[model samples]
Target: MTTIYLVRHGQTYFNRYNRMQGWSDSPLTENGVKDAKRVGEVFKNIKFAYAASSDANRARNTAQIILDYNLANPPKLVEIPNFRECFYGYFEGMNSPETWLLTAHQAGYRTFNDLVTNFDLDYAKDLMHQADPFHEAETADQYWQRLDKAFEFLAKQVSFTSSDPVLLVTHGTTIRSIVGRYSSEKQFDLTDPPRNGSITTIEMNQNRQIKVKDYNKLKI
Candidate 1:
């Protein structure tokens, strides 16, 4: 079996402002740095064999900070661009969550409340499709494909037979995609997105069947 630790990057200015970050590359907030340090402390005793993170600076910084705190001698850090947040296209930097919600409703989507009340695969796909009519944004399928590829790449790079744990630090969307792939679920709960500085763990058998041992443990 292989143990995989998936961590979401710390909070950012965009996160606090409720913006559509996508590939915006915002710097971490002061609170974010503090949160990252706390996350590092939480895993201070755990040693990982390999560490990987999204190419985004937020994720990369989080991985480095965690390693600096935890491992006496950190393993090599690999950058994986595939583990990035879902691209929001032209909507990037937008902070109008309410406008988006209204747009979804106008498009005949179940109301935002209804969508939240009934978060399922069909609902998720509909939201993605309705959100970006021009197809400039990443579709649900594209998001899942990137996540699936990242996991397959990780599995190939790591020694499944070894006991050492592998760490993956990435964005909330990327992490959600990972969970969706493993669970084979079509619709994802809005709550499924991990908060900044949160960690989730999964255990996988040799056959590559994954079991989510823990989900969304936040480090304050």
Candidate 2:
């Protein structure tokens, strides 16, 4: 079985500004760097077989910092475009509250949280896709397609079959959406964004079966 550690990237300028960050690049904030370093320290002893991050600068930088803190030889960091966050199109980089308000109202939701939590989060993602005027935002299907491809890339790696754990640093929404979709454990708080530099652990067998052992943890 392959142990996967899904890490949310550190806080970014967009996160501090409360802006929509999907598929939108942003630099890490001072707090972001510190938090990532803290996470690195927390994981300093755990040896990782492979380390990778999304193509986004925020994700890549966070993974780099964590690898730098590794006590053992850290694997080379790979940048995967398939691991990128969902495309928000017109909503990208907009004020997060304003964007959610627009989508919520258009979807006949009295509040933004109501829209996202009414059904599953994937349904909410489809709702957001529908809300985009440019019609370019990723739908549930598109997001899943990309995610499936990302998994394929991992499975292709020879070291992924080994017992050593692997690290994947990506965006907040990407991590949440993945957990919501695949994790059998439904007790997690999906409404709130995961803490910066938090780790979510998933176990995957050679059969490609995935199981979430934990979510949103500061340390393993």
Candidate 3:
């Protein structure tokens, strides 16, 4: 069995402001840095075979902190852009959730809760289409395809053995996407999203079947 540690990147100013960060590349706050250090200390004993992070700085910084604390000579930190947060399209950097609701309402759509709770991919696709009427960003299909490719690449890159563990530092949405692909849960809970600096542990057998051992559980 191979154990994968999926760590959500630490808090950011965007997080505190209730903004849709998406691909904006926000930096971690001071609290975020401290949380990352604590997370590193908590996982100091485990030696990861390889550490992977999203291309975003938040994720890269978190991965670096963890590796720096644990290993004298850590494995190379690979940046995978495809594993980025969901593309919020026109809503990027928008701090007003109410504004998003208004835009969606005018576009014949309900709130994000409606799409996320109903697991309505069609609604999500429509929202993406309507968000960028001029089409500055990728379509929903394109985003999904990108995530699929990222997962394939990571799986191929990490030749995991029973003795080795893989660490992935990424965004909450990216982690949710991966979980949705394997798990039976159709919709994520909107009321309580994954907490910052939390870890979700997953175990995969030789047949590549996944078992979620823990979710949103932080050692520190």
lDDT assessment of candidate 1: 0.74
Q: lDDT score, residue 75, model 2?
A: 90
Pitting candidate 2 against candidate 3, the one with the higher TM-score is: 2
- Top-TM-score structure, candidate number: 2
Q: List model 2 lDDT by residue over 1-220, tens digit each.
A: 7899999999999999999998899999999998789889987988888898999999999999999999988899999899999899899999988888887876677555686577677777787888898889899999999998888888777365477899899988888888887776456778777888999998876566778788999988
TM-score ranking, high to low: 2, 1, 3
lDDT of 2 at 216: 92
Q: List the residue pairs that clash in candidate 1.
A: 120-187, 121-186, 121-187
Relative to the unseen true structure, what is the C-alpha lDDT of residue 99 in candidate 2, on a scale of 0 to 100? 86
Alpha-carbon shift of residue 195 in model 1 (angstroms) = 1.8
User: What is each predicted model's overall lDDT from 0 to 1?
Assistant: 0.74, 0.86, 0.74
TM-score of each: 0.86, 0.95, 0.85
Compute the lDDT of residue 207 as modeled in candidate 3: 53
- Candidate 2 lowest-lDDT run of ten: 107-116
Deviation in angstroms for 159 in model 1? 0.6
On lDDT, the candidate that comes out on top is 2
Scanning candidate 3 in windows of ten residues, the lowest lDDT window is 183-192
> Which candidate would rank higher by TM-score, 1 or 3?
1
